[model samples]
Target: MFTKILIANRGEIACRVARTARRLGIKTVAVYSTADAKAEHVKACDEAYWIGEAPAAESYLHGDKILAIAKLSGAQAIHPGYGFLSENAGFAESCKAAGVVFIGPPTQAIIAMGLKSESKRLMTEAKVPLVPGYHGADQAIDLLREQSQTIGYPQLIKASAGGGGKGMRVVKSFDEFDAALASAKREAISSFGNDAVLIERYLQKPRHVELQVFADTLGNVVHVFERDCSVQRRHQKVIEEAPAPQMTPELRHAMGQAAINAAKAIGYVGAGTVEFLLDQSGEFFFMEMNTRLQVEHPVTEMISGQDLVEWQLRVANGEPLPLTQEQLKINGHAFEARVYAETPERDFLPSTGRVSTLIAPETNDFVRIDTGIRQGDEVSMFYDPMIAKLIVWGQDRTQALQRLQEALSKYYIGGLNTNLEFLGNLARSADFAAGDVHTGFIEQHMAELFPEPSTPPDEVFAAALWCELDHTQARASKAQRQTLDPCSPWAIADAWRMNQASIDPFEFQVGEALYSIQGMQRNGTYYLKLATGEKPLSGERIQGDEWQIVLGQKTLRIKIIQSGNTWLVFWNNKVWHLNLHDPVHEADDQGVHGGGLTAPMAGTVLDVMVKVGDQVKAGDALMVMVAMKMEHTIAAPKEGIVQEIYFQVGDQVKDGDTLLSLE
Candidate 1:
């Protein structure tokens, strides 16, 4: 076993690796960038070392610097968790040359499976089922177009050297072939530094099921069942479950064997994921293999009772497989939902800000929370925006789903936009509960999951009334504290006079729906008059942002956060972003309107399609900004001539900064 290992990663995966190292009594070293000096992963390790700036090119991807740090820290091995240098064949070879064990597949295995086109070729030779596609090495544009036509409509153009939807495009017709190919190559080169691509038959209704396979130095390879990652958005997984709902024993065996064949074909060692796309006819095709630990490995761990990281350590130390294939058993059904700081309503755009409030549900043997951030952590723009992963388990899928929904309700994140509401909706959706999932699940079932904003629920209005009253009391107390004569009401600068019949009028907006309520205090309870009727509401802050409230005769626990004039009411596994409809403030702020197009978030200007004196119509693309790896295009609001271009290409602009103004 490794006496010490340095984790060449950060965030949740880094912390996850440290956890297993601690259990095995192995000292762990962590490397951090300037932005992550105070990150949770640093504290999770036994020692820390500084690398470079926040950019990955300057820090995590510098394998030479990392190997040097491992040598200095006396780390016997290096664990490159998931991204960055995890799948870099050059890095693995460098580790071997440095005499430091790399706790992953050998360079041979990584090189064999690094390219999708190359891997598909090997899978073909290994007799693993493969989809009909073109995997040739011809990079000519004319030749690629010919191949696309040969593959027929609805074909997939995938980056040969990448995953994560970075350099992929789906063409539905021949007319769209040229543009799609160019776009795919552009994104492919930008993401992976390789413009080569392959064409494949894009199955309309396919499930993304991947088998977790392991290999040791003794040439012993075994499969750890499979995980169904069919629920996805933007071509990335959102929800994953193990043992795949309704998986037959025969199909499982066949897929498992095929996965093992691929692993052996590549001379694989350590942990690797063999992805397969199962069609509606019960036939499966080979997808690319991930050469490192996966982001959703927790689901496999929960069901198999295996610590995959520990397995990597043991395998690196030349130990044999921990358990034989027959000894492995599926204990229960498990589900993992990724919690990201993103706005699902806005095309899942990444949200950046400080996480002022992060209240997660309590975890137990059946529920787990894997996170590397505490409260007050900044969701930086320099890396992935995933906050934490919520994993839950039960004896069956039904029970596990019930646990998942309940756990999601108890999570509350404040100070930035998040997809908590979206996750809750997806988990509770009718189609999702019925196991009708695929890569296009979100798009097909979006109507039910992404319902239009409606009038505020009655409880939300009641919570709003409570918030206003609480704010009033807080203001009064603060005024009294700042007064010279605390004993005198006049010195307090408060004209506070209250009576039970005093009707406190309040109005707010949930989305565009307007709502108003009258709150009156009587006895120990407060009655609120909304559109429905008068209801008794009472609540008090129990601790932190939590509130214990009673509506009528029912008791509930919720959290309320106030930012500016907006109040987020966390109740019933949903978030209600309430904006107080103050007409005075609205009039004061709506004094001027302009034809200026601004940056939606802080990002670099990737392209400026229009310049000064350029005539454009509404909806014409003006500027493109890239932030958090997602691109947002600024469009013209109305027909006008571009009078001034404030920022050009390569300029970094903050959120809401005008990129160009129109006349």
Candidate 2:
């Protein structure tokens, strides 16, 4: 085995590779950008080096700079962990020329399967089942229109070199073909530097299933079963599982053989995935092949008891396959849920901030957490916003899924919005539990997934007040210790006296609503009064950061932490942040301008869909902005005439900056 290897990626994948390398007694080297100076991945490696600035183009994607660092650090190999430069054919070839092993498929294999057009032609020759589509090289608009008609209505226009849902469009009719084609080409060129596209048939309610295949230098290839990635949003996988819930033995055997054949046809080596779209009629069609490790490989690992990264390393060292196809068998069912720092209520918009507090669920032989972040880590806008991957295993699918729900409820994060609640809801939904999943799962159950917010119970509000009172007493006790006065009045709880009853009113704001609460202490007993009702309550600190509260006949144990002016309260698997309202200071609100359209997050303007004086209707696309490698289109709020455009293509804008105005 090689002594040391350089990881050419960041975030969880980098840390994941280092873990396997260390287990095999191989030294690991990590590379980071300016934004990741204190990143978890950097600290997980044996040695680290700074490559360039935060932008991927200047750092992670710079093949030459990474190669130079590999040579300087005396690394014998480089592991491209799933993104950035992982699938770059040119980078793989350069590594070979430099006498450093690239722990992935050969350069020729990458070129063969890198482009959609070329890969389809290759698969057709290999006798692999393919969907009916046009994979020709002609890029003329009229020619594409002709092909679209032949393919019938409701076709898909996919970029020849695209992934992650970028450079893709769905056309439901001929009338929408022209504009959709133009937009797809523009996005393809901007994202992948390839404007070429292919037309394919769009199947309804298809399940996305993929087989994990591996090859070695000795021309040996084997299959590692399959993973069902049907639950998706915006064409990206959100939940994945191994040994598909409804899969039959016959279908699994056929798919496994086809995947292995696809890999061998191109002389593939190392780890790769062959994706397929399973139709409702039990028929499957080839979609595409990923030339590197997949984002959801953990599900496959959990079921097969194999370390794919370790396999990649062994194969790159010219070793033969570790286990043959006959020896590999599925041990148990597994599920993986991708936890991201995003807001589901706002269409899953990505969020960025310093993680003020993070507490992951307890791990054991059955539950695992693959993450690169800890408390105080910053979720930046320079890369993907995936917080972690939660994986669970059990003797059966039902048990495994049940464990998954339990783990998600225990996961906690603060200082930024997240989709933890949304994920928990989906996991517990009746449809999901029954395994009625597909690519349109989220859209199908939108109402249940994003249910109307219910009014919080009085206990929650009382708990928030008790947390504040504890904080006040702790601060006062510290002050009393320094003054050498054991009987300092400041040490007593506020509004607590030996005389008559005293009611101390406190105000709090949650979201846009203000709540009024009064706490009364009389004869060593406490009562809380709100607009809704009154409740007798008592609270006592239990150890650190935990409290026991009694409301009438019910008792609850809650976790509370105060950071700045926000009080984070955890109860019954839910987290809430309530800001204490200060009467001394009031917020200044600027008058709302009806015609102003602003950017919701920091990003670069990719296109201005409208011009000054252009008439538009409500919900019309006005501009396109790219942030954290994802594209979002800003739309008009009402029908109006465009009066001004403040930013153009390539202009960097901050959050809440006005992009345009209408009249």
Candidate 3:
């Protein structure tokens, strides 16, 4: 085995690779950009080096700079984690020329499967089952239109060199083919530097099942079963599982053999995945192959008891296969849910901010958390916005899924929007529990998945008041700290109420709704009154940042953290932000209002779709902003004429900065 290897990636994948390398007694080196100077991955490595600035093009994607760092650090190999430069054939070839081992498939294999069109041609020659579509090299628009008509309606236009849902579009009719093709091509060129595309038949309810296959220098290839990645949004997998639910032995065997054949046909080595689309009729067709370690490989590891990274290391060191195909067997069922820092209510837009608080579930033999963040870590706008991957294992699929739900509830994050609540809802949904999943699962259950916000229970509001009272008492005790008194009146709940009962009315706001509650002390007992009814309430601070509250027949544990003027209350696995209303210090509205377009988040303006003096209607795209690798368009709120344009393309703007004004 190599003594040291350089990880050519950052975030959780970098930390994940370091962990395995350390287990095998191999030293690990990490490279980071300016944005990740103090990142967890940097601290996880034995030695770290700064490559370039925050942009990936100037840092992570600069193959030459990474190669120079490898030489300087005396790293014998380079592990390209999963993203960035993982699947770059040129980078792999450069590593080989520099005499440093690349812990992935050979360059020839990567090139063979790099482009979808080329891969389809090769797979057809290998006798692999393929979907009916056009894989030709003609780039003419009229030719593509002809092909689309021949393939019938509801076809897919996919980027030849794309992954992660980028550069993909689905056309439902001939009338939409031209526009869809143009949009897909533009995205493909921007994302992958390639404008080539291929058309494929769009299946109504196809399940994405992929087989994990590995090969060695001696031409020994074996399969590690499969993972079902059918639950997706925007063509990206959100939830994944191993030993697909209700999979038959015969189908598994056939798919496994086909995957092996596909790898062998490309002369593949190291870890790779062969993806397929399983139709409703029990038939499957080849989709494409990923030439490196996958993001969701943990679920496969949990089920097969294999460390794929270690396998890649061994194979890169010219070692033979660890075990033959016959020796590998599935031990149990596993599930992996990707937790991202995004807003599900706003169409899953990526969110960026500092993580003020983070609480992860306790890990054991059955539950695992693969993450590279902690409290105070900033989710920047330079890379992917994924928070972590929650993996769980059990003796059966039901048990594994149940454990998944339990773990999600225990995970919590604050200071920014996240998909935790949405993930928990999906995990507990009846349809998901029953395993009725496909690529369209989220679309099919959109209503249940993104349900309207629920009103806070009365106990929750009472708990908030109890928290406020505790704070008041603590402050009073601190003020009286100079004089020590065993029977200080401040220590008593009703001490401030001298001879008569005191009723204090407070108003709070949650979102757009305002709630009013009155706290009263009657005969030394506390009660809260609302329009609904009156309830006796009591609370005690349990420890740091936690409190136990009792209201009527309900007992709850809540965490209350104050930020600025708002209090963040976490109860029953949900977070609520309550703002105290104080009329004394209220200020007049001075921010942007009426016909002004402001940025929703900090990002670089990618394009200005409208110019000054241009007329636009509601929902017309005015500009496009790119942040965290996702594009969000700013649209006109109502019909108006653009009077002024503030920022041009490539300008960096802060959150709430007015981009333009309409009259």
Tell me the spans in candidate 2 whose CA falls farther than 4 Å from its real position.
476-493, 496-500, 530-533, 583-594
lDDT string, candidate 1, 484-557, tens digits? 88789575433235543656788887776777778876665568887777888888889987787778877777
Error of 2 at 601 (Å): 1.5
Compute the lDDT of residue 95 as modeled in candidate 1: 94
lDDT of 3 by residue, 117-144 (tens): 9999999999889999999889899999
lDDT score at residue 455, model 3, on the 0-100 scale: 71
Candidate 2: the clashing residue pairs are none
Clash count (model 1, backbone only)? 0
Q: What is the C-alpha lDDT of each candidate?
A: 0.88, 0.88, 0.89
Judge candidate 2 at residue 218 and give its lDDT.
100
lDDT score for residue 630 of model 1:
64
| Superposed Cα deviation of residue 639, candidate 1 (Å) | 5.8
